[model samples]
Each structure stands twice: as C-alpha cells, then as structure tokens.
Target: MADSIFKRYLEKKNNLIKNRGILQATYVPDVLLHRDYQIEEIVDIVAPSLNKDKPSNIIIIGQTGTGKTAVVNYVGHELERADAENKNCRYIYVNCEVIDTPYSILYNISNQIITDPNKKIPFTGWSLEKIFNELANYIDDENKIFIVVLDEIDMSFKKNGDDIFYYLTTINEMLKNSRVSIIGITNNSTFAEKFLSPRIRSRLGEEKIVFPPYTPEQLIDILKNRAEQAFYPNVLDNSVIPYCAAISAQGSGDARKALDLLRISADIAERNGDSIVTSAHVDYARQKIELDAVVEVIKTLTDQSKIVLMSIIKTPSSNDTGSVTTGEVYTTYVELSKNLGYNPLSQRMVANLISEMDMLGIITARVKSFGRGGRTKEIDVNKVSNDVFSILSSDDIFRGMNLNQKLKKQTTLM
Candidate 1:
C-alpha cells in the first residue's frame, strides 16, 4: 500500500502556535488589558444585582475591537461566578446581529431564561407579544436579576425597528417578583439618537458607557499579553507584535485586528516551514485580510449601490491623474441606468452614494475646488482591484451588461 499523501505534512511538527484559540477575538482573557476603568465601571453598575436589586439598563458604544463586548462578557462572567451559591443573578448574552428581528430577539431571551425542556419556547410560530409574556413570567418565577447583553444591538434596530428595545426596557414593569436589566452593545455610538425613539433612548441609555479606541501603545500591550499564551517561546520575532499593533492602530485601533494579524502571520510562517514569525509575514497577512474584507463589503452591497459603483468604475478619467469627477460619474451612471431600463437616481443622491463608498474605503473621493464655480469630488478607483470587478460582475444585473464595451463608449464620447 502507498503511504498516505498527508504523511509528510503530518510529520512536520507544529512549533509556532501554543494555543491558537487564545488569539481568537471570541476568547475572553482572565484579565483584559487597558480596560481597567471600564471594567470597574461595569462592575459597579451590575454589583447591585448581587443584593437582589436590578441594575440600570446600559448602552456600551464603541468602534470594533475596542473591548466593549469583552468588558461586558468579563463582567458578566465574574457576576455569575460571584452569584453561584445564591443564584440570585443570571447573565444572558445574545448577539443581535445573528438573532435579529423582534420575534427572534424575544424568543431568544425567552429560551435562555426558560431552560426546562418541557417549558422551552418554540423556535417559531409564536407572536412577539406571546414570547415577551412567556419570557417575563419565567424571569419573575425565578425571582432573580436577569442581565441580558444584546451585542450589536444596532443591527436589530436596523432590521426590525426599536420595538424590541422598547419591549425589553418595559419588561421589568410587567414582572412582580423579578427584574430584567438590559446591556446593549453597539459599534455605532449614534445609534440611539438616530434610530431610536425618545422614550426608548431615555430608557436604554440610563447608564451609557462609551469605549474609546485603543492607541498603538495600548494595542501593543494587548497583543503582547495574548502572544505570551498563543505562541511558543521564540516563535515570534521581536518585531512581529509591534508591527501588527502599529498597522491596526493606524486604521481603527482595533485590538482584534492586531491579534488577527499576529495569528495569520504565524500561520503563514508555519505553512512555509519557517521557525519564526517576522514583520514580513505580518505584511502579507495584512494584505490578505484587507483584500478579503474588501471582497466581503462589495459582496454585501445593494444592487443599486453596485450599479453606482460600476458607473464610477466605467467613468473615464478627466485628467492625466487617473481620477474622474463626480459630474463625469453621474453622466455615466445616468446613461447606464437608462440603457439598463432602471430609473436613474438624481445626481445629488448618486453623490451621496459615492460618499458612502468613500467612507467604506472602496474608492477615494476628494473634494476639488473650482474657484467660484463650486466644488466637486475627484473620485479615484485605485483600490478597486480586478477581484472587486469580478465580484460585482457576478451579479445578475451586471451579467447582462458588457462593462468593457460601456467603458469604451464612455471613453469615445469623452
């Protein structure tokens, strides 16, 4: 019998990662770095529950990887540990991004609180009001303080509306023997002011906590702490962690991104049979992660947004700098929309879409002044690679149109 094809690869010893799970974003450390004040504040807020009292509803706002969710999870874990004997406090974490919608959110909360199989809420076929009543009754029956952490709470608001939030906030009023406290976690700090009604906002924002972005120094400390447990001794070069932290800090100061960079860099080194992870590996990992992110963002864009993007892509540069004016993009968009039998958005609306894409880093739209003639944006698609074009082209609307032919016609007209 022939030796297995994987025999040689299997024989290669794993020397780089001591425990890869330690580098994951979901892995909460025993002690979170650079978030001492936030942790203490959360502890103080929830400590009332230990005495069988309800804590105020909390809204934790911050950018991605700023330790908002981590701090909440850490505090929840510690709270549950402290209440193990009396069982007066219960912690439930629900990621709203996954379990979005009014009915699903209520159902998820109900299922968590109602653990008995015979009394478990059905996954579907129940009205939102019914689910809320069941969830409230179960909590009141337990006579315990329930802390429900709604991570990415903004997603639920965007999908269904603020009704679920209103329900949760008013749930305590329905219970006689127990209380429910909400902890909403969101990346959008303005979510409450923009999307929520005044009543919901005032109730949910009783104790709002804003988490600031981590600086490069803070990111370095975070990465180093995780690195000690994630990698073997001498596996990572002296510069690997610093480089990862600096790159992530330069963008959003995300500790998760830094840890991801470190993990992917080590993976690349290990795959190449290298003993030590270096700054070069970190560079490769950054590029790979960025490309993957761009592809995903483009994939999730609405069809209209994709058409607007394609118009920008097909627009001819007005000068030798390889950038097109917003006017030029609008003209191309109007013609393309007409030919495709789709209603063309107004130039102002198209400009707003362009600005949105600019915010996403899909294109560079810089305002160029024209003296007294008013200013227009000079849009650059330098970051939109062929991979992006392919992703957009796979859509049904784009499948029928020849992008190259459209570009040629636009160029000839220019």
Candidate 2:
C-alpha cells in the first residue's frame, strides 16, 4: 500500500513537470533562424562610416515579430565589437516607446554623452527649448560620433508626430564637435514616410533596409535553439516545437510568437501533470495563448466599449451574426451601462463604440449595404466571450445574472 501511494505521487509530480514548456524569449539563446543575411546587411549599413559625414541613418521596416528589433539590437552589439579599435564611433539603442517625444529622445542622447551617472542639467525642469539648449551644449562637449537607434519609431510618430525626428536630424548642424546619426526601426514600413514632411523624409530616407519574415524551417531552427537552453533533456516532443514555429511563420514569421507558444505549452504541460510536452500540449497552448491575449486586450477597453462587448456576448449567435447590429446591441449596452451608471449613448454614438471595440479585436463588424438606401452594420464578439461576461457582471449593475443562465442564453443564441 505504501509503494502504491508513492507511485501515484511520482506519477502526479511527473505529470506536473511535463506540462511546463521550454522555449521562451527571455530564456532563448540568440541563434537567429532566418536573419543572418539581414543582420549582416544592417551591420554594413551602420558600420563606422570612414568619412565621418555624420554616420548616415538607416530605417528598418517589417511586420510585427519579424525580428526587426532583435536584428538591430544584435547588430548594435556587433558594431560595438567591430568598432572597438575605433574610439570615434559609438552605437546607442533607444526604445522610442520609453523615451517617447523628440525632446525625450534628444535628452536621452545628451544623458548618454554626459555619462556622469548621477549628473543632471542645471536647468530645473525648463521648457523643452531650454532642455534642448542644455542637451546641445552637452553633445558639443562630448566630441564623439554617436549613432542612435530609435526602436518603435512608429509609436513615437503617432504620439507626437515628426517634430522630434526633425529636431534630432537638424541638431547636429549646431554642434561644432560631436556629430549625430540616427537609425529608425519600426514594424510599419510606411511609418516614417507617411508621418514626416518631405524635407524630413529627404533627410531620413538615406539608407532604408527591410527585414523579411522567417520561413517555417528557419523558425524551427530558432525553436530548437531556444529549446536547448529552456528545456530539460528530452522534455519536449521533437515535433511540438516545430509545430509552433510553423504556426507563427504563417502569421508574421514572428520569433516572439513561436517563443510564446513554446513557453505557454510548457506551462500547460506542467499544469496537466505530464512529464513531457507532447503535440497535445502545443495545440492546447495555442488556443490558450490566443484566448488569453484576446481577454487581456478586452480588459483594457473603456467601460462603454466593454459594455457594448458584453451586450454582444449575450446576443443570439454571437459569431454567426458576424456582429450584433448597433441597434440590436444598444439596448443591452444601455441596460449594462445604466447599471454601471453611464449615461446611455445614442445609436450614432453607439456606432462609434462598435468601431472602437472592433479596433481592440474584441469584436468585428459587418456592414450590410442597402444600395442607395444606406447601410446597417452588425457586430460579432471574437475570442473574449468567456471573460467579457465576467467583466460586465462584476459590477453591481449586473448583480442578478446567473452565469450558468447567461452561458445557456449564449448557447441558445448561437
């Protein structure tokens, strides 16, 4: 009887370990799958320009998760190593998401130059103008050639427009000693060109490069590399990682997606009390990761949008309806909103709300054309049906809802 209990315990423990997947980004090694040629091309573009005519800036463009940032980051380190003998050239990477506006971008560059670690500019929170002047002074004092990389350049442009890019590119003209060059990286190919004025565009369009998606085979190699570091010996079925790589390759050739799948698969494996990650774990992980992503995205919606989404979840045939008509969804939206204390919105306004939810990926809209008579749009809730109900009913306004009943209502509608 003791032996039997111990055997059962071992089985459960082994099942737990198998559920955990290897191959997460934070844990993955840097063996790039399909990016070798792209990396080398970028290195050539950014390598210390012998002429010192302000290291010419380069822009990299690709779809999301296509290794745009990773390639640039990897190349930056290589450039640093290659240029170690030449003290004049330096590589600096800035995530525009964090630094944000052009002033912040320039200020960050100035701080890097000052390198005091604890030093601050004397001006006490002056306007962006005064800050720029101080930053210019610092750059002039440094007497070094710096290449700054702005990742997520698209986000910066969307937030504050091209004024920052204009400033940074032109600021070097004021410097008597140091010179500045910039490398803008983005997932949006049309980002810089669309946002900048012709003159600013002219200055920045100098050396443009594009990184393409990885082939499935390449992604498989990438998965293998990450798995070696992330998993125990023979923990993952050989086919599972490749299966994940193949899925991500279809979407955007995103290494991040592949890595996320591998990690989530392992977690699922651990939860199921398995000793090895199997094909089943990978499939389950994909659905789970996708659902979680949709749920988190929906949670961030404005209260009104969430209300509109919750209304759809309770609608008849949520997916088959494509989208609930604004007219159809508005009544439920209002009831939920009133319970939540929001003033009911007009149908025209509800139309806007539908669009907002569509943008958040919580729902999709289908417009029915009435020839010249006009059009009516319908809405469909996508992947967040389970959580949308929870968010809406969590408020006292939805206190009477029986979750099982609501679920049944959803079933009947579908």
lDDT of each: 0.87, 0.73
lDDT of 2 by residue, 1-414 (tens): 357756755666543232233444544245566777888787667665433546677888888888887777777777677667766666778898988876777677666677776766542355777778777787777676778888998889889988888887888888998888888888887776777788887787688888888878888888787677666788888788779988899968888888888887788888667788887888888877766766677657676766676776765544444455667677777776777678988878888888876776666787877679978786655444655566556755456755345452331111
Question: How would you encode candidate 1's per-residue C-alpha lDDT over 1-414 as one tens digit per residue?
Answer: 998999978898888998989988778788788899999989999999999999999999999999998889889999999999989999999999999888888888888777789988888898888888888888899999999999998898888888888899999889998999999999997787798899999999899888999999999899988889888898888998889989999858898898899989998899889999999999889888987887788887877788889888888776877788899999989998888789999999999999999999888899999989999999876666555666678878877777755332222100
Give TM per candidate.
0.83, 0.83
> RMSD in angstroms, candidate 1?
4.7
List the RMSD of every prediction in angstroms: 4.7, 4.7
TM-score, candidate 1, is 0.83
For model 1, where is the 10-residue window of minimal lDDT? 405-414
Evaluate residue 158 in candidate 2 and report its C-alpha lDDT on the 0 to 100 scale: 88
